[model samples]
Target: MSWAIIQQSLPMFGKGFELTLWLSFVGIIGSIVVGLICSLVQYFRVPVFRQIASVYVEISRNTPLLIQLFFLYYAFPVLGIKFGAQLCGIIGLIFLGGSYMAEGFTGGFNGVSKSQVESGKAIGLSRWQLARYVVFPQGFSLSVPAMAANVIFLIKETSIFTVIAIPELTNTALDLIGMYYRSNEYLFVLVIAYAIILVPLSIILTLLEKRVRYGTFGN
Candidate 1:
């Protein structure tokens, strides 16, 4: 907490926090795309794909992320795929986050009453039409809050990337500690730095949850 240490760590923490923000943003987008696709497969019960998505979600959720990162970084190279630590870290985190998001969306799909879907079918709508025009839009509201929470969780989870030398916030804080041997001072800034990025996301997600509910149920 010394003034000198605070001044010294600012640049390092800022740079690292920037990288963490960018990494989380990119990973969350990738996870959302993957999650939605997988959810669709599960919804329609596509041939063999439901099985595949199930396996993926179960395995990803069951395994620790650190292990996934190691597999991506160490095992993939053995299979002739070259990747930097940052790339590998992103891939692992996306795979992990996508599974959780898919589960959340599946819950959303369930939240839409079967009667709504039946009504869509009664209107001469095909399954695809019902899903696109009716079901997905309505059902997705049921899970948007969970989905947003998952995204926020992904932001905090980026702390693990420090283990991979990803130059994220935690990594830079540790580096500062190493350089100045002021672990206490650097750690405090690290906590605040992450909070600065994440606290607003939490607030946004809460507001979004209310909005989704209002749109789906209130109106």
Candidate 2:
């Protein structure tokens, strides 16, 4: 409602948005890598690694990002394992997002037809070769929708970074509200900032999903 307040807050919000983008980008990438590793471990039923991956997924998925962030930012320092707030934020996002991504990827792997796997075996494809050539491609394609959802989820989860005093968008908004007492204006700006990033991102992911679904991405 107060354009002046909103205008004055733009620089702060811009900086916060920049940090949010960085955190989200790093988190998404890390989560994808972690998820891929875990899912592959499970898919292959690796000896000890499969059990470890399953336990890790269960723990990560069961816990809240806030709790994980607190442990990383607050609890770990008590044990002499300290990380900066930004690092903690990134780790928290990856920790939580990775589990969801693993599940998504596992689902994608499951969606791979059994006959196709058999066919790959019949062709004398090694396990690794089959995974690289047949399984990974189809699984990733099947995973597009879930991956998009998880990316969006991780981006939104960055809001929780405020608890760790990360200068992300939500923190910026809270600071503005505390300083000016214009909760509505700051909240509106916060919403708009997220919309600016997420709206286009959502549209792009949707388009990518459609392309993957019908445009021969995995084939």
Candidate 3:
């Protein structure tokens, strides 16, 4: 409960939090892109790509992210293939989040009404035109809640990067605990830091969802 120690360690926590934010941002974007592409192909029933997307989602979803990170960071090194710890952590998050995102997006795509699609076809919309103009916007709108939940989960999961010494928030907290021998203080800080970041994000997503539900993207 030493305020002084906590104050001094603020810089360290800031650095770790910055890295965590960077990882989360990049991971979210990568996951969304990967998920959207995978969902789209599977939704359209594209030949080989659809199968590949299925396998990717199945394997990524079934496996523990910890094991995936271990394989990439540890096992790969043994085979003379290597990635930096941060890179491996980012890649693991992307794969894991992308799997969940794919499922969410696929559900969203299915939620679109069949008659709307038929109407698009009757209007002579090309397949790409149908998807781009009519389907993706509505599908993405439907997916927003699930997508927000997945993003929050992915941000929290960034704590696991500590296992690979990625120096995210948890790792910084651990370091402070070792230095000050006050685990409770640092743990409190960790909780506050996460709350600070996640609470606002959750609120913003909620507002966005409401806007989407009302057919307004917002001002």
| Tens-digit per-residue lDDT, 1-219, candidate 3 | 888878888898899989999999999999998998899889899999999999999999999889999999999999999999999999999999998999999988788889989999999999999988878888888999999999999999999999999999999999778877889889988999999899999999998889898865323
RMSD score of candidate 1 (Å): 1.3
Could you tell which candidate, 2 or 3, scores higher by lDDT? 2
Which candidate has the top score in TM-score? 2
When 1 and 3 are scored with lDDT, the better candidate is 3
In angstroms, give how far residue 202 of model 3 lies from its true place.
0.4
TM-score, prediction 1: 0.95
Model 1 per-residue lDDT at 194: 80
TM-score for each of the candidates? 0.95, 0.96, 0.94
Q: Model 2, 73-178: lDDT tens per residue? A: 9899999999999999999999998999999999998999999999999999999999999998999999989999999999999999999999999999998889
Candidates 2 and 3 compared: the better one by TM-score is 2
Task: Kindly list the per-residue Cα lDDT of model 1 for residues 129-203, writing each as its tens digit.
Answer: 998988788878888888988998899889988888899999998887787788888889988898898888889
Output the worst ten-in-a-row residue range by lDDT, candidate 1.
210-219
User: What's the CA error at residue 126 for candidate 2, in Å?
Assistant: 2.4
